[model samples]
Target: MIRRNVLLLGLGAVLATTFPALALDRALTPEETQLIQQIGAHNSAIRTMAGRFLQVDSQGGRTEGTFFLERPNKVRFRYNPPSREEIISVGRGFYVINRKDQTQYAYPQDRIPLRNFLGDKIDLLTANIVDVTSSDAYMAVTISDDTPIGVVQVGLIFDKQTLDLAQWTLTEPSGAELTFSLYDIQKDVQIPKSYFYIDPTYKAVQPK
Candidate 1:
């Protein structure tokens, strides 16, 4: 369950969307390079974002949730009913709260795969991009980063026309995959600071 939660919030992003692997050392075309910059610019322009998300695990378990994000560090995911789970990052670290059992597991924000996506300025070129692909509808970039568990691959997809982030996928070292897609996303909206707040007094168990 702990590992699942780690991937849920740590490795979250889209279903089985696959693209042929591109050599990591290959040079990026000028168009692809420009697209990556545009995506980064689009991301940097957003101060806050709120949306509904659909999370699907490798086993096909589906979960719906509402998410809130504030630039540079904070984000929250409140899963729907039957899921007494919430993942919150209050800048410094991430806490996976299991409301049913009143248990909370904490991990350093920098230690999770989501750290790259939640940065103040998202520069795809600065990331360890392993793959890049584009079509009329979508542009995707896959980034590889190391975490405590192991190296994890994060695939980010954007709408080609708008360059807005559409979905993402995270592949764990153990071969488990988790996907997340956002909808009804409102950018640069006012999200209460309290939404990112995590209770300091709550006892948190650190993942081993």
Candidate 2:
């Protein structure tokens, strides 16, 4: 769950609108809407990537890790050892595992927010593109959709210059804000499929 929780957060100071019941409480002009669609197209260009990430919580706690991502619903976030938490998406399931405890949690990929970006191809135009805002350094795209957890909103940030995903933030219905920032990113890298395989020995924790 740490992976899921961390995936919902953001970094440093930003010019942000107040969180609302609906992610898009305001309106997007014709130009702004088209720009967001264009950004979505740019995102889908990434076929594979590997990078390091810093997951910062609202409390200022930070965990660092290396991530391997292959398109079409496969990613592996291996946190530095002491953290003992890893998140992997294989096929249609999201698996969060604790190395030290040998405990694992699994959920249908659709149950989690932002799976659109995790797919083999990123497609924001097809989803509920609730809001799109940008700053000098980052373009923040807020995607809102109804999941089993009710309505969920995810803010995916891309570097304005490169149009690469920089970070993502989300405020859980419970008011937990989580953010993840990526660095040392390399694109079109080879990632082994074994990286996503769940250990059969790990104990599965059923969702409540």
Candidate 3:
């Protein structure tokens, strides 16, 4: 059920995306801001990333998928069997397809929250950040913003030493959290452009 949210957010930490109605607005500390800059630079350096993902919804339901990502707003998720869902962004908008029902959902690219992760220069300093906490192992950034649907909150965890995104938890408007864990990430691999193509015939379902 929350698989949809994962696509909206799980695009990976070449990967992650969020909203929260009770927004947190404040000036980031100098040190906090600098760290974000470093993380953003690290993320942007990764031009392409492909990996396997494990997503667990608030209800603890699990779904598996393969994540493909290219910089500046192109990503795809090929869900495993029994899931029958494929989510892709073609530098324009996000397309969610249901193989079993032959249904497709579309959302404007700009309307998707936490899009900083998709840009050529992942800029967290400009994000509506709520808080940031870091440890020797990783740095966690919590961001919230408004979207076409509702408020969403996204927590991104980056491995401190390597600066690679380890995982992320996305909290939807309903306060349901979906956690996506990415592994076996291959960076800058040759992924053909056809991987992001969406057929013209699929019907579009408007976001709720």
- Order the candidates by lDDT, highest first — what do you get? 3, 1, 2
lDDT of 1 by residue, 1-208 (tens): 3235435334324323553343376899999998889888888889799999987777887788899988888888988887887888888878878777677777777767677778899887887777877778898788777676777778888998988888888787777777888899998889888787666656777654
Across residues 1-208, which tens digit of lDDT does each residue of candidate 2 receive? 3536435221222236455446466777786667666766776777788999887767777888999887777788898866788888886677778888898877677766657787766666676666677778777777666655556567778777777788877656565666778899999888787888899899998644
- Candidate 1: deviation at residue 12, Å? 9.4
All candidates' lDDT scores?
0.76, 0.70, 0.76
Instruction: Give the worst 10-residue stretch by lDDT in candidate 2.
Output: 6-15
Candidate 3 lDDT over residue span 1-208, tens digit each: 5457545753222123334234445566797677778888988999999999998877889888898999989999898887777888887878887767677887777867647689888988787777677777778888776676576677888887787888888776676677789999999999998889886777767654
**Model 3 stretches astray by more than 4 angstroms:** 9-27
Kindly report which residue stretches of model 2 are placed more than 4 angstroms away from their true locations once superposed.
1-14, 21-27, 147-150
List pairs with backbone clashes in candidate 2: 8-170, 8-178, 9-178, 9-179, 10-178, 10-179, 72-120
Badly placed stretches (over 4 Å) of model 1 are 1-3, 6-23
The C-alpha local distance difference test score for the whole of candidate 2 amounts to 0.70
